[model samples]
Target: MLKTLSAYIGEYKKVSIKTPIYIIVEVLMEILIPFVTASIIDKGIQAGDMSKVLMYGGLMLVLAFISLFAGIQAGKYSALASTGFACNLREGIYSNIQNFAFSNIDKYSTAGLITRMTTDVTNVQNAYQMILRIAVRAPLMMICSMVMCFIINPTLSFIFLGALILLGFVLFFIIYKVTPIFTEGFAKYDDLNASVQENVTGIRVVKAFVREDHENKKFSKAAGNLYKIFVKAESWLAFNNPIMMFVIYGSIIALSWFAAHFITDGTMTTGNLTSMFCYVMSMMMSLMMLSMIFVMVSMSVASARRIAEVLNEKADITNPENPVMEVPDGRIDFNHVNFTYKKDSDKDALEDIDIHINAGETIGIIGGTGCGKSSFVNLISRLYDVKDGSVCVGGIDVRDYDLETLRNEVSVVLQKNVLFSGTILDNLRWGDENASEEDCIEACRQACADEFIERMPDKYNTWIEQGGSNVSGGQRQRLCIARALLKHPKVLILDDSTSAVDTATDAKIKKAFATKIPGTTKIIVSQRISSIQDADRILVLENGCVSGFDTHENLVENNKVYREIYEVQTQGGGDFDEAGE
Candidate 1:
């Protein structure tokens, strides 16, 4: 809890001093108002002097104005402090996620990361905003109210203290029970999010299989479990409020009655008795506010820990401080590389692999699904460090280079390409932020995307729906290629990037790359033999090992698996060429 508080407060070192001063002024006003009210009741009202009455009454009104003005000023700063704090923390988390290696991203599911970004950040923001207003003020009002009560009448103050202790215990019980429930609820929320996202994204597959009912039931089960957890947490949270109101009201009633008896006994004046009632009311209200703070604090604390879990994660991959950057010309090498998914396990993803490639050469990786072709490409880019041996770019180990330089030298367009919500030009500029209109169009042309994009009314300025859902799978892949092409990296990887497009379109796109992006090294990972048949070399992977590596013609001659794959792809060797037009 203290760590969470420190994390939030640390965001605004600049306004720290000024914020507390404003709080002090506000608290002081709160303390003074009750005292002034008692004096008006006892002295001014009893005397019935219009001038004297008007004087203290006007003074009370002036104090009210002063308090209101101070509250407004404090509110403005509190908003500034909280807004700036949330913004910085959110940006820091986003930056950290962006830098996280592939291993780290795979460890946390997409839904889990989205939850942290949206719901978790929102929780922290609410807690931060609340701390300045209720967190600080509640304690001040509680303390000062207690102190004033004792000064007015010590006997009644004891009752107030006892009631507070009871209320505090109740709130504690509320937190102790509800905290676990909320944690479970948020976890369920993640499951629900994952189910919904998967169903929506894979809606075509689900509908094709006629599994809408199955998917709905799957979603319903998750949502139902979440509903139970949400109910349990909210139930405990709800139980506290009414109990708090009853206890506080009961305390106030007892205190007021006790003060009345004192007034009749002439030990306390009527105004003093009235003031005690007023203080009791003020104190109870503050205590109620305090109860709410603890409840939300408990809930948000759970969320903060979840968010901090991601923020505090140290990725499995990071650059060494004085590391050498990989060569930009893409002379890639893997010297007896043995790699594993687990750090402390004997399960190898790839073992006893040795390979090298010259700059500007095209390498084709052909394998069955789960043959570690994807893993091999991931390693080249230093997404995950090889466990047992070194992966070198230009003879220097990948770990030696700074992440930014390594990434800039190698570009990858994944099989599942995502386009962010923006204009076509904006999406392309992701590869090269300062790329011009002409550069974008040229890239689009090379990727076979310019024709369809130009037909849109807005052309380059046409909007891309999130995940590029508005466009066909082929179009999304093309745009992603254009985006990657715009970068002009030394090593370009097409990781089954044209799987969505027909063979003819894929061939034309590759031809464009050969013509326009000359001297750029290419790594094509594809299941379709024809897709990579023209490469300078092809690698056949079997059970995480590189079983064969050679030219397409030679692989067909020498490698049985490669030949078989080619046979399976072509069947009768039908032509993919479009009819002359």
Candidate 2:
């Protein structure tokens, strides 16, 4: 995990290195001040020489100013390095997430990824800053102070050694108890974030159902879980400060008692005793800083592991080494394909699917819920790989094609219609980045979206709210259709994308597809029989397998499933799924 996280340091390596160099200089200056104080007291004050006292005092002032300057430089560099490291981490995680295949994405929840990118990365950033400054400074200060104590009087230094042993054991115990709790707490963060995301995204539905109180209770439960975990961990950490203070005070009293006897016996000078006091405080404070560093590092270890998981995750689907660069035509063939969403699953989402579609042919797919209408089309664009057999376009295996090349040639308008927070033209431009204004208007016209565009004040330039929330459902669907049309793909798959539009508008969009883009292989997945009755051929799916694949009239006469659906819809207005049930 450390190795993975360190790779994202990128360009900040120099600043990170400079922070610790400045910290070392600051520690050296701080350590020298106590040594100088001893000379001023013993060689000058006790011997009645004011010149020596003034000289040592001036030298101490110089060291003190140097320490202050070094400290300021360390602080500035640590902040720059840590914040830069955090920015790089977030960018690396986001860039990796963009490359994740559907299977890779399914392994993590939206809220979980968001938490890792934000809260987890921030924790690691803070820990990195502490490691660069305090981690380097504390141990150096402690060791240097210990060496100074030993130089003055070796026997007196044993008292600090015993104190160090006691505090080390106490700190170790506290960290061991706290580490697991912090790990569990970060997992609770994912739950808390998930609750907020779900509530905010579906706020309209929650208000419509009058479930505000329920949502409040749900959020409170997640927040309460996190609160309990932190409190439990903090209760253990509360012992740290008190224990450190007790050890520090006890060591000081012992030193003072021993030094008084040593001074009386002429074994230690009064100057040396005073310097011992300064060294003891410096050593004890360094220990305290070390303890704090341990706590921070313990918390960030969990965050670091979470971040590494994202960075190390390799996409399950990738382009072949020597990939086919172009799609020849829209002719799609699913040759005995078998697929499952989960790798370990026994059941397939689509099983033994053998169907062929010629270039420019219009095909309609009808099925009940969970009958693999979306799953079948998903394979056409290689959104997922088939478990068995091959899904081919233009008689070439889809896996052989470059991912970008294949996806660009086969544009899919999913069941969920999505639009970004931009102008209507901006959303349409996603289909073709270099498409002219005239080209965009033409695509909108073919999708029958021009009517609404002309009615709006700004027309194509009107800003769309996030997720196109400002627009009606039908308007959103038409705009999405227009966007897909701008792709000029060899094959276009509309997975119930026209469900929101009225039947007349749906018919017009279909007619426009048949006329405007004749060479594009069109596949429409719908529950409405009237929407697809005029297609070249229709596919009927049942339980992840094809029940019928033929012309609508031929299916009505020969296929039981198709006859039942036609009878129900023609008589009293029922959907394919309703007829199936």
Candidate 2 residue 352 Cα shift, in angstroms, is 0.6
Off by more than 4 A, model 2: 578-581
- Which lDDT values do the candidates have, in the order given? 0.82, 0.94
Pick out the ten consecutive residues of candidate 1 with the lowest summed lDDT.
Answer: 572-581
Candidate 1's residue-wise lDDT over 1-581, tens digit each?
34643565564865644565677777778677778777777778887766766877888888778778878877888788877777766776788898788878878888988887778777777777677787877788888888988999898899989888988888889889998887777777789899999999899899999999999999999999989988888888888878877877888789777877887889998877777777787788888888878877777887788877877888778879897654757789999999988787767889888999888888888787777888889888888889878888866788899988887888898877999999999999999999999999999999999979989999999999988889998999999999998988888998888887888988999899788877888999887778898999998899899889999999988998888777765885642222110
Lowest summed lDDT across 10 adjacent residues in model 2 is found at 572-581
**Backbone steric clashes in candidate 2, count:** 0
The global Cα lDDT (0 to 1) of model 2 is 0.94
Clashing pairs in 1: none
* TM-score of every model versus the real structure: 0.91, 0.98
